[model samples]
Target chain A: MNEDAVAGEKSLKGIAVYPGIVIGKAQLVDRSKVKIQYQYLVNTEHLNGEVGRFEEALRVVEKEIASLKNGMAEKVNDLSFILDSHLMILKDNMLRDSTIRAIRDEKINAEWALKKSLEKIRKVFEQIDDEYISNRISDVENVTERILRTLSGKAQQSLSEIDRRVIVVAHDLSPADTTELNLGRVMGFITDVGGRTSHTAIVAQALEIPAIVGLESATDVVADGDLLIVDGSTGVVVVNPDDRAIIYYQEKKLQLEDYRSSIARQSHLPALTPDGQRITVMANIEFLEEVTAVRNYGGEGIGLYRTEFLYLRSKGFPEEEDLFEDYREIAELMAPESVNIRTLDIGGDKFVSELEITKEMNPALGLRAIRFCLKRPEIFKTQLRAILRASVHGHIRLIFPMISGLQELLDAKDILEQVKMDLDRDHIPYNEKMEVGIMVEIPSAVVMAGVLARHVDFFSIGTNDLIQYSLAIDRVNEHVAHMYQPFDPALIRMIGRVVTAGRSEGIRVTLCGEMAGDPLCVPILLGLGLDALSMNARSMPLIKKIVRAMPMSQARDDLKEIMGLYTVHEVQQYLFERIGGMFPELREKGYL
Target chain B: MEMVRRLKIRNSLGLHARAAAKIVELADRYESELFLKKDGRQVDGSNILSILTLACPKGTDMEVRIIGEDSEQFMTELDALFQGKFGENK
Candidate 1:
């Protein structure tokens, strides 16, 4: 009744990663094809003034970037060289001369002239075949966008300028950008690119802001200030909705809101089945910013603290202190709660820090994770030292990623022991008995789980990589994505074995992957005897709601029944049918 | 005085932003008018973006020209930079 929806409506469907509904104004943050509201010629009288306006905007941007570079330069070095190139782009005479020429000779406004210069430069860049060099245009485009924003006095695209709540429309919101939207002005998200498991969806769900991802064209279609009805529950986004759609959704919003609050009230309670079996629900976070969201979602501890953001965000090698500051902050925030810090799992092809002369042939199988760390012990020790130092702050645990065999596991542990001795001799205090764990994601590791379990304190099954390696399918390749099945009986059998291995060794085992977050996969995971399930914090409540309803005694039997069926389709069907019968609410129109 | 030199881009990344910025920074010191030519296309050697548009990858052959009172001195240092691979070998 309160929110009004206009006419000329169009609806778009996408994978709804989070559940909620909101109607708000749209704010487009697509920096690629910047939208300019004005493009008019300047009068002869104001021609000089316009040129001066352009010059002043350039100066302001120069100072803005210069100060930013200086600020980051204090804590880190060498990375400034990356930001320094932006300064060069901003001050490049090619852009300056062409823009000023267009302003004076063509009699155009500064914004129009700047855009014209940008288009010309882009044209020149488009001819280049090198993907890396062609990609550098984004850097130049970013600088030009800043200049345009400054010229129009709208330089504050930092989202704080928005007074009213608006849904952000973007190409893709990275982990950093997702957390930065903690701004109260932003209500929801509609991104053109992202999967159901992206950090944006996880953050949106954890923050209770509904999100719809993989819309493919939301950024291009939604204009600034256009009325948007974002229904994350139904996985539908209605653009410029009419009156009937608004009234219908308004009531649906109220009912869903009531249902979510009821779930939230009991989310913090222990996740125990009627048969008295308990499971620990934890959050898998990559940045310090998500720690509060983890706790707010009733996550008991950090299940997987992915440390790749340090390398990814900087687009260069981050220093030890940079790693320490992030690890320390997350540890302090989640004090008394065990934070499992997984050492860097990023591949070298994506790594920008090393002066890569030639990219790897196949990075996923090439020098990555524990393999790369073993080769570059200095890079490895840098992270190990930081993690060890931060372990003094909270209940921190170290988990090595992609350990294919006992040799890699023992070799990585040898380096960790060496780092501890180095720290101890220097009188640096660390947890003398910091727990160590390995990701039981590799098929070999699963086969040798009994041998692998004896050496580590815990086993965290990384299903994302586990399914990929075991099934031998690239998870992102659309042609075989359906083949990358989570319910593949082989993987279920492997997880059952890993849990069995952990129990034999008297150590706890957890599942920390997308499967851990999936509602359809929860009962099977419970029946397999996993001690904990660490997933996107947003999925905790939904998973808990399912766990709270079913008794573990029945789930163990359900697992045994489904395990008898070998094919993915049969197992998936059996689980879905079981879930439907248990909670008929899940059968309501793509509710799963 | 005018001077010209032919050089090979020894750096593996070619004329990327950092490498081009190095050339631009070196050009800033000399009074010479500097220009770079590759495959019949010439660009202002001191403009980073202009130099980048050349898109010379590693092993590409290019020519450098300097015209001013500082031409010879600029040529000497430019040759050193070319041979040094813009200090990126590390």
Candidate 2:
């Protein structure tokens, strides 16, 4: 690195994605040396000494990797995927063979051969034009740095601690950087080469660090020992910020802190309307680790617990014992509190690693949720066994998704029975009286609800999918997504029918999708006879506040007044004015 | 003595770059010296191209039994890693 080259580089500015201020030394992630090493490796040698060199080089690389891993462990939330890469390279054959050949024929040293071999593979990735596949540059640089340092016999220096807050800027951070980072001491993160969806961003978000990514030369602009401020919410970073700017932002920071404490204080209080109506606030969890959020958020119980997370990091089926362990943990944590577990809703758009349910032209309409479960009775049975076994530990309800009709329901129920009988035969304990529920997403379920509701214990309307299917639009397809309206008359009518039918059968009716969490639809759903509202944990407190502000009678009346509206905009505006007109403070605060 | 876990490239594309990288990644995570074997011959599991060279096609089940401290977790993760099509493009 030349001093002139560093001086010639210009600064680039962009929005900061997280907030805080700190000044720290710089750690550059350089890979140019690896490129040079690659260019020099073209020869080969076949000798015991050459083989020994390769072995020695590998040991050095391994040690560097170990030291890096130790350095990054506490700072990162998840380093499994990153470490997994190193493991693969250490055992890689093509790289070893190519390097050995380069050593034997090209007459290159082990370090150069390794670099050259990695470059060739990296070039292949670059040609693919897929970021997901091509983003192995970080991994390559990490491995090269380790191997190079090892061969040079240089002891790795200990990373500096963040005694005061600081901003970390990098080309891209390895999992080691994440693990080794002292997040409490660091203020935020800004990276030049990582995507928002990349592992680096995921960790930064988990640590609640303000992070901005995809900047071209962020690391070059923010100098070592220069003061830097990160605004996480707006994704803004300021270099050597003025005092006035700092004072203004300091107030903003204080306000945010106040709001956070207010939200926390309200968690323990029941969400009710000024007029006495109560709203059920529940938590949605993807993993058992998130159960803590439910308690922290003061949620009533688990509304939706996605079971797919258990299968996410594994290749085959999760061990029945492991699955049982996780389920039991949740059940025990929420004992006497109901937790609704949805059956594995894989296939369609979601490709399960172990089971690739048929790829279809229309995944949302194809074999998924209930349909997939019915097709693979055994897979369904295993989950059902685990859920049923878990039920004995607490109050648990099993919900089937993507239900279109009676037969899918019947066949699924049949499998559930077989699982129960098997458990009984094996003398395994389970909650025999566990409630069964169905997500009314398919139009057929809505149309024949009166007949279908007779057999179910509860019906939860999954409005996100229901709206997409009802409009014949793909919610994920950006072009047509806007046309998928939850407030469409047809969707409203379907929801009305399902809720009415459920009440007639003496079955509880709930809305568990995104629609359940929306403040605008609260009164409309209550007017239509929805008995419960289940939504994500984050939105629970605010929705509860909305529910508590309105009287049931007033809500029903307001719904009746707005029901005759023909369009979503008309309905939205009418409700906004009616609700906001009464609560000016809430409306002014953007609570609507 | 080190043991090897040999899994053929069962994905549609012959151990495309990402899949190959994934295999290498998984092998390095544990204490084992993992290798991919083909027809009684073994190649380093950590090398991206050597694993791809085995050219194990879709539906081809390659054995990946390991011997190391984290062997069980390694083998289990390897199974998923191979099956994911290495975050395939398209």
Candidate 3:
């Protein structure tokens, strides 16, 4: 009940998309409760006046959209394209004429007529087969809703009007709704429906705001102006927390800020052990624009560029030229530092409808990554050719993802060789000496790392998948997610074996996974003799700070003891005790 | 003075909102009464909703009719848009 939550009785749990801690008053923007009443015009003489009223409402909505566009012009580059479409919809004579016609013929109020016009447009949009175009219906609905609100004389309630900083609790925020939020006055946001990859979540991350999404009853339980604690790191939302809980989180917030500032100060410094051993720290990026973040956080190079985004974001297969241009730009930007381009790792969570792959019983273990690429060589070759062509521009390295065995690795490389031969025949210039590598994410890959290492230049351990496959747990499934342990003895042993295997083959081994970014796991990974650590750009500075503070000799010694531990709990306990003392910041946050 | 030209939508996305907006923007610049006819259903070229109501996808053939003093010049410019695929490659 809202009463119990407001009385400081309970906390809600959700998915943590962006990490931070914030305490603020809750501002409920319940758009779903806004009901529009359909009213009919009683008099015939009011027809022209009704049409004029509708036009006036349209103008007001247009001005609102224009102001919104101007407000976000500097913050977001891609917003203009969406706003431009909204402007077109507002200026649409078809919408205007039809609404006026309906008002005259049906003797209805402007709101009802506008709704009718929107319905006609919605019907047309529904008939369209294209997914991208059909999605535009939301834009139309948003614009029309604004107009209807204006027609009904509802005063605009701007998020900017809040006198103090607040945490927005909403059913869900559209991209436009999220943009309208004044980031300065808003500390964070909690939504009832959305995932990490949603537009609102991405915008929240860009704004550096704490956000907890997919909390089904966030709006219902959290009352307006109730003091709320949003722990985005742990995905906990304490509605009207008790004094003690507030004080604790407040101290944690300060500690987090202090920790962040300390790491940021050490960002430009090299990631090195106290014993003066340099450990290369690179970034794993999904979008090309994130390179700026990578550079800002002091990543030496791109360790893994997830190329599946090219397919996921596209309506159909991305043309080779477009792919080439994007790759070339990133390569040119990071000139001397290598860009390890991972070939298309589609299927599973990242599916392209155009691929028309049948639904599998278990997508994670099904035909995906290297298997998907091998099955669709035409698509794979297009990406390979683009990467090969871009290789000449900078230090480019090709990495194959989800290689379960030596045969899959060889088959993928064979396709690459075929692509290279085609490029040679076509007189396309590329870096012939571009390094080829495989992601050691599969248990089989770890077992065959020595043989696989001999066939490649490097090994990047994708711990997220490796732990999932090794422990036989789907990380995304909440029921089994608790079993997905990174500190499991089996996972640690497998990773250690892969590191040794790469060393035996005289090749560098890197960890480009969630575990690599985790500060508590960094000492153990460094001790395991990992040549490099790659992670999200945001985590680079903190990891680097931890790595710089730790002595390689001590970590190596601690690793032997850690490996000897029999269970995940023992290994975790050992790491907590050891890493906690070394990094007091981690200790204060209880991360260790 | 009426000028008519038959053209095919070349852009893969057909005449979606953006493309329809382009046609309307260009059509509004002239004094001619521009009408777009597809499969016998004609709508005002200057109205995006009417243009969209035609539901013209890629490869759909349509007739553009302009009736006014500047009909010839208007037809020429409209033809250019069709040929250029409204500046959208995909």
> fnat, candidate 1?
0.63
What total of clashing residue pairs does each candidate reach?
Answer: 0, 60, 0
Most TM-score-accurate candidate: 3
lDDT of the candidates, in the order given:
0.81, 0.66, 0.80
Task: Compute DockQ for each candidate against the true complex.
Answer: 0.50, 0.26, 0.43
Query: Sort by TM-score, best first: what order?
Result: 3, 1, 2
TM-score of 1: 0.77
As for candidate 2, its interface RMSD to one decimal place is 4.9
DockQ-based ranking, best first?
A: 1, 3, 2
After superposition, candidate 1 runs with Cα above 4 Å error: A1-9, A34-88, A102-136, A147-163, A171-185, A199-208, A219-225, A348-363, A472-484, A566-569, A584-591, B1-90
Instruction: Encode model 1's per-residue lDDT on A30-102: one tens digit a residue.
Output: 7655556555564777888888888999899999878767666243344466567888887787799889999
TM-score of the A chain in candidate 2? Answer: 0.71
For candidate 3, give the lDDT of residue A427: 97
Clashing residue pairs in candidate 1 are none
